[model samples]
Target: MRSALALGPGAEFDRIRSILGRLGERAAGVGGDCALIPAGDGQLAVSVDLSVEGTHFRTEWLSLEEIGWRAAAGALSDLAAAGAEAVGILASIGVPRGAPASAVTTLMDGVGAAAASVGGVVLGGDLAAAPTWLVDVTVIGRVEVPVTRGGARPGDGVWVSGRLGAARAALDALVRGATPDPEAREAFAKPRPRLGLGRALSRLGVTAMIDLSDGLGGDAGHLAAASACAIEIDLGLVPIGPGVVEEAARRSDPPAVYAAAGGEDYELLFTLPEAASLERVRAVATATGVPVTRIGRVGEGGGVHLRLDGREQEIHGFDHFA
Candidate 1:
């Protein structure tokens, strides 16, 4: 049997769909960011996020509050991608041996604060003892018309919200046993999901949408594959986060690599029809306080292409099993 590492996330999703067979077809959206289920008078968007101690973060690198907040924020970003309104969250925490009760409460406080910021609250959850600290959050959201990844069409302009790579730079700093700059640290600890912008885009008739959790390269590829179209990203147009250039230089790589392929940015990647005009997109930024930049265009094909320095380049993002 092949190991999970060999299959990777994309292939593993296909394997899961194969296992579910016909039953999987019942869900409105599967193998996307979140699953949409039919509810009375509307649909619910739900997603589960897992934060493992060694895998996702280190205790020395962040406070318990930051850990909890990061987990919830990442999970809730899925709802934003679906263009849903925040509802609530159910968090399941795994406590290891000798864990302090105060630690757990502090973590819960952060979780509650995150949910409340988005007009949500903790709906209750389960607890268990484990070998390592674990936080699993299931965020629920509601939407009248949920956006799906497979809605892009040729000629749609590809865009991204906010900036990218600040979290990646912070991760590199942590790995090096150094503290990141204040801005990068804030971005890493408390990423602001583009909830308002996402809802606005959905209302404005975006063709497709996905959050930048696993970096622009991988996420954009997923969008392309889902929409059965092609995306050409101009590397020069990608918005690199502050300090990312210096971080990339330290690692002997171009800033574009980190900006395009660094995971955990939690911004939105969406497409608008050519008819949507640049003025309209900029107006959204004015309204929501989040800048949206056009970095590419969708074409009639499959897969994502990156053009840097007038040539094509290949890059890969984070993969849990890999």
Candidate 2:
């Protein structure tokens, strides 16, 4: 498989198409770029994301399978944020000239696996040549009531669906030429988008939501800006993932720093009105088996504020053009 993937472009592409055709047989709603089907009564939600070699991932640091899984998971996380049920995904790939056929197939296989995990399938896609490997995934979802980042209001409580920082910590370890803890590596390589949790929150009338792709602080700022509200996060309330605290200790950095500013966790961050019942929240958490934590509240102004031991702290996550 490794040797096959190292082959030249022409043969690699042919092999890729063959594999895709077989995989598409079991995946419904797959045909062309545009999928024609019956429109549901609910609203349709669509999101697109791109993952590139050297930028979003490093081939030297991760297996092709891991890279593929991360790319698809990141794209689907958007659907999870909107509280929508995924319908299908369209993948577009840019393969470097000398890249292996096996690698491309593995990448698509990862994409297919992620789609199935979210009760979706690969509808169709396009392929092209590029200087570096790239994968672009577009997700289509349906929702009775679409959640948006702009819906947060004053007095609303901020919440997160799962722990944070493991993904960032894994990246940090890789950048430093060290192997990450197994749990942290798994968190980065195979993030599970909170699709079920999003649907439950939507049903429970969540006001605003966003996936924790760009870290808690930066993503929270996005929600605040969109909703024209201020958000204050209690650092102590942030759920740091396992191994993160130890990693922080090893680096002599505060554990809260990673929870606040680490990126690519793929967890859901949302808001609910103050009047929302804690009982209902607990029920949802119990039903979904996904931990839900209240980290802060929506306030009267705009921007995200982090409070550490009652003092304000400044933190931000990843930015492509920064």
Candidate 3:
């Protein structure tokens, strides 16, 4: 448990490089300022995410390893939303004084592990000193047909991949100093980006796509705004994860609140053209092993609305400034 201050900068950098090298084939040909990859005729997709201590996460609630994985996954989720296959990740981290070198090693290991899970490699990064731990990851990916938020047209079907609210439930439990179900804990610590499902949807000709990092309500509003179309979400059609209902019921809180507004789900939310058949959607779901649920439709106009049992309901998800 030697402090980073004792290890100095050069030794720490070497340690990181050594850890990344152990990724084997995943880390092949990764070095220098950038990693090289063959683009062919397809387009390259890039996205960056920043995770800060105390703001985006609490070290007390999550281990250094979990924090690393969560941060890397957050960045990779953006590439998934673009219907891209991840190529590699560049992680720039700031370590605080008195931080243990072992902790930092665990963090890098987590990052490499997450990247390897999605066929991604750890290419290169920068390290610096800071007052608090900071993690920023830039993910590079490739997409033959890039899906965007502005592609949804009026009369298209709105769909979501996988269930929601488990991450929010885990956060709530941690804040209350209570332990949540294993599924909820995993959802918070290691969210699976729907990369396979996103690729399949792109091949299926999906109109628009986005990842559910900022909760369904807010993220759906983003898609609606970008497309200049109104989105009507049927709460009844939304899939609620296990334990969410019981937790909400016990607290006298409506489960729909979490289902609609909980953040960090990292699931894929997309829209398909009116001509897209349910059978086709089901086929993609079967192929990717990711469940797809149709919860609403795109309509003319702009904004996002919620419907519960045919009644219009008001709801909003996470907003960093609000």
Candidate 4:
């Protein structure tokens, strides 16, 4: 068995650490963040994420620009999850042999545009040939008040920024014969990270944080597990977007499922001290013009549970690499 220090939230780290222990007691090769390199501390916040053609999006439904936007935003959302302000990005694009030259150019344009959307820039990237299209992005950012998933306190209040599940609906609609509305299309095509809100919340003294790129249930569970506390979320309080509820009703799928299982909703979910100021959350919403919602509170030190009609229910968020 491996110690908690080496468990990067899964069995892979545990398995590797166990093998290393058997080899001989020695220092682990990797450090904080994502690679053999330490995630770094004090100033810079580093994060990387990947979006593949088949799993993340379909070229037929989304334009090159839209695809670029989704791929870049997915990585930026990780930085947001850590409450970091992004400065620049590096993108590596994998082109299919059948991809058109115009499509490739548009994809590049979208990467540039996505970075610009967050007041960031593209530093550099690599081009490669692949059987299918793929885009990998690494974002570099700095946060004055870094918020990590492991910082939650037992009494912290749990919150989420903006609406959930719209992206899932957009894709489902596209998969079916139904046409997506402008808002749904935008949600699927170009997801905007709440970067401003993340910075503000860090200054506001949030105990811990993560982006809701995964379903809210799963993501919040991550926060709870990391903090060694129980997470209690109120389903009724989940901020559902306009048109989403009606459309979900039309589809006969529980709106809660999308809100809980949707993978592309790039919103921020965080925990704050029970006594933290509401004013800061309000200020963030005002400055960014994005809604910040209080869906639940951290429970007695334990795991995560979704509270519906005041009853606890079992659920979790999305984990692509789990």
Q: What is the TM-score of each candidate against the true structure?
A: 0.93, 0.86, 0.86, 0.86
- Clash statistics: count for each candidate: 0, 2, 0, 6
Q: List where candidate 4 sits over 4 angstroms from the true fold.
A: 1-41, 250-253, 319-322
Better TM-score candidate (1, 2)? 1
Which candidate's lDDT is highest? 1
Estimate every model's Cα lDDT from 0 to 1.
0.85, 0.81, 0.81, 0.75
| TM-score, predicted candidate 3 vs. hidden true structure | 0.86
Runs of candidate 1 with Cα error greater than 4 angstroms are 1-28
Q: RMSD to the native, candidate 4?
A: 3.8
The Cα error of candidate 1 at residue 144, in Å, is 0.5
Extract clashing residue pairs from model 3: none
- Which of 1 and 3 is the better model by TM-score? 1
**RMSD of candidate 3 to true structure, Å:** 11.4
Q: What residue runs in model 3 are displaced by over 4 Å at the alpha carbon?
A: 1-40
Q: What is the overall TM-score of model 1 with all chains considered together?
A: 0.93
Q: Could you give candidate 3's per-residue lDDT for residues 147-193 as a string of tens digits?
A: 87778898999999999888888888888889887898899999887
lDDT of 1 at 225: 77
True-structure lDDT of candidate 2: 0.81
Cα lDDT tens digits for candidate 1, 1-322: 1111111135535555565565544534456777778899999889999999999988898898998999999999999898998889999998888999999998888888889888898998888998988899999999999887878999999999998999999999989988897798899998887778889999889999999888888888878877888988998899889779989999887898778989999999999999996787888889999999999999998888989888988877677755
